[model samples]
Target: MVAVFSEDHVSLRASMKGLFAQHSSESEVRRLMATDEGYDPVLWRQLAAGQELQGLVVPEEFGGSGYTWVELGVVLEEMGRALFCGPYFSTVVLAATCLVESADESAQKEYLPRVASGEAIGSVAFVEASGRWDEAGVTMEAKKVAAGYELTGQKFYVLDGHVADFFVVAARTSGEISLFIVDRESAGVSAHLEETLDQTRKLATVTFHDAPARLLGAENSGWSILGRVLKLAGIALAAEQVGGAQASLDMAVDYAKTRIQFGQPIGAFQAIKHMLADVMLEVESARSAMQVGLAAASGHEGLDLDEISPLVQAYCSDVFELASHQNIQVHGGMGFTWEMAPHLYFKRAKSMALFLGNSDSHREQVAKALGV
Candidate 1:
């Protein structure tokens, strides 16, 4: 693949880093985490309006920046480093990706503009109690009605569901899975907040009892659309994981250099130096893997997403989790306390490891992609 980073991309990354540094400080992250909304609307507005980040991957005709996946991946990486709390991943990565991949032009025309403008928050409701991220896991049912369709069932662990204006739901219709757009304010819709391990990211259990719905894409095509959406999600998340891992390694190295166990710094100790070196190697490897994954995702190298997606997801997920654990070990007892920021990343790494799919599942996918 060609070099993914250009002068403009470097400038954009710097701008995103500056934005997060200015707004998502540790104190700010803590303050927002305590709030019910789990994010700052003013800061979100600045990102969407001032910086136009919400539209980074959206086309210009749809009222967006018309940028490529590289830009989107970089922005997500910065967000992971800062642990910026919001509906960005839900709306921008999942929902917007579905819209972009869909063949339904009318839906794109209607919904993409709203998402681009930050006037609406969108989330995809797919996983159920089974906690499976595939088509076979969807048990929600949708029935045909006079006006439109009616859905009955529940979706668990929907990201940003409590605050979302609409949901792109996956439901079984006539023994086949289909995608539907349901308004959050509909009469039969109920959204209850879910207490997740990662409080930095909001999640909810959304139930539908004869909820009004509109079809998205084609009939029995939800699974296909979901495949593309999940691939993009994996790529974006790999970028984020690399960022988090790098930050965790940085934290450990900095602490080792300053904290003294004996006469000299702990970093001067051979054991501490070896541990930090191992973490650095893993983080850098994950970063390289993510860059290649992004290039494949952007179709820049003519590489298939099927082959690269699972590899990056599995490797990055493991790397981030390992880095977080090592960071805590390096900090000793201080890292386990709630007052420390390392715990935040530790929680996030554990939670996100299961988001799209766990490392084992992705590894399975990787093997299958390789004809194993």
Candidate 2:
């Protein structure tokens, strides 16, 4: 069965939109981006206490809202529209999903409540220096120790790693890929912030030198768990890209309608009209692709997420890149300035395009899945 978009979802979207408009304004995003923590703690708490946003997909038994990915996609879309500078994507989408999918009840009971309440922040350390997001990319070694295990290796491009309280780290255990939970404050664990194209989202390089860790799921089964998490993360990210594309279109259209040129609004020009129209088409089509991902993620029958996830990711990434670029073109010189919002969206588009994997890589995955 296909997932239905209900009035509740509409109401939730409206609520989140208002919340972000107030708390995650352009100025607020700029301010938070420059901060070390990279997000407003007060707003983060409000999301958990008032909106229960952090627990949207967490099961009810673990103090979460127990909602499905469809609702979570709505929240993420609004966040993308506002360019929210927070660790929600890392803590909820990446870390929480890993734990939930691992099927380790002990791990869930121990850590999920804290995540659901926003009392603790978490992220995943998956990619290494090679910058590959696949099973072959995991080279961090986890050796058995008297206490449990000890990890020694480094991870790069870990989203929000500097601010995370703990990490769901992927490492090689006995020559097999496995998952481990390591506290940020653990001995021999260090994180350093890294410069990135998108300032709104922070990335970090984390090194684990004999850091004590606890096994998350069954040893040697991490790649399977991570595969499911990546699929869900791809769907969620597609929703975010759709929102950003729409925002870019809105920004361009608004500027065109007001910015006067040649004795009339620039929107009156055939060139500007055609450009905006093309952006609109792309945005609308990207929304459709995002919906397909959401449906597949929400357990809609007869949908193969492995196929849909890559397709959605590739299409949305391309559409968002085009929309943001066209938004800059519409504004002429101002769009290129650091003061304008177009550059912000453009940077985010470029960064997100490479986050999980690039468009070409996703397309290759789709082709491989098709056995072509």
- The models' CA-based lDDT, in order, is 0.90, 0.93
User: How does each model score on TM-score?
Assistant: 0.98, 0.98
**Can you tell me which runs of candidate 2 are displaced by over 4 Å?**
1-3
Steric clash pairs (candidate 2): none
lDDT of 2 by residue, 39-125 (tens): 988888888998898988999999898998899999999999999999999999999999999999999998899999989899999
* Alpha carbon lDDT at 84, candidate 2: 93
Give residue 319's error in model 1 in angstroms: 0.6
- What candidate 1 gets wrong by more than 4 Å, as runs, is none
Model 1: per-residue lDDT, tens digit, 114-183?
Answer: 9888888899999999999877899888899999899998999899999999999999877888899998
Please give the TM-score that candidate 1 achieves against the real structure: 0.98
